[model samples]
Target: MNVYAKNILRFVVIVFLQVLILNRITLHWFPEPAGALFIPAIYPLFILLLPFETPVWVLLLSGFTLGVTIDSFMTTAGMHACATIFMAYLRTNVLNALMPRNLSEYINQQPSIKTMGWMPFLVYSGFLLLIHHLVFFSVESWSAASIGSLLLKIAASFVTSMAFILVYILLFTRQNVARA
Candidate 1:
């Protein structure tokens, strides 16, 4: 399939999985911090998987669309939109900072375990995940009284999201390797 077709498919699939399946999974039983803390949002993986050559405006628009879709389903206006835009905006900087100096030729490729190496890919995904989750949860609980609980919620969500993203990469990234 062509790149545009592939991206469309990926966007649909990730959004469906996120809203229909993964969003329903509760990592914890009680709502100590909040009931929403356990929902693992893997949809950001779509943003992460975008081709590196994708323009900044395109990335931001895609991120905004993706986030708005999630927000529509989850009934949290602008939360996902803001977080996803943050990730998309910072994606290039993270990629440039983590990737090696001589690897500019790979700039147009989609990020995956096979192309970027497991460690670098994880670090890249983890950092973005942390940022997204931090912003997301903070926005969700935008009260000074809940700052400490928000921090904990962000940390927990980050760990769970990283684990999910790592597992996803391990399972799906090999296709890119085989093609390469």
Candidate 2:
């Protein structure tokens, strides 16, 4: 399939899953301190999957749009937009830093375990997820007035988001490898 068509499909599927399925999930064991961190916000995966060769401006625009879509559903104003754009800005540098020296030729491809190896790919995803979750939860709890709780929330949410992303990558890795 064409890249544009595939991207549209991915966007639709992920948005549907996120808003319809994941949004309904509530872990009673570890509820958000401020009730805003339960939503996994997996829509950023779409931004992460964008082709590396895509223009920075295009990536930022797409990230902003995706964030806005999620914000519209979650009613969080521009929090997601702000976090996503921040991550988008950092993506290129992260990719460049983690990529193998001799494998720079694959700059046009969307990053995956097959393209970047499991360790680097996980590190990249984990780093971005941490940043995104930190910014998102911090903004959501801007008036909490407790630095300790905020740090704990960020750390917990980061671990939770990493688990979600790791499971997602594992589940789809086979399909991605088959296609490649």
| Stretches > 4 Å off in candidate 1 | 29-37, 101-104, 175-180
TM-score for all predictions? 0.89, 0.87
Tens digits of per-residue lDDT for model 2, 1-180? 788998999989888988998888754325555433465557778888888677789888988998999889989999999899999888888888887653347655788887877888888888887888888878887876787777776776677667776777777655644555
lDDT of 1 by residue, 1-180 (tens): 789999999999889988998988878534764534479889999999998778789999999999999999999998999999999999988988987763346755788877788789888999998889988877877787967667777777788777787777677654644555
Worst 10 residues of 1 by lDDT: 28-37
Instruction: Compute the lDDT of residue 32 as modeled in candidate 1.
Output: 61
Q: Give me the overall lDDT of model 2.
A: 0.79
**Candidate 1 global TM-score:** 0.89
Error of 1 at 126 (Å): 0.4
For each candidate, what is the lDDT?
0.84, 0.79
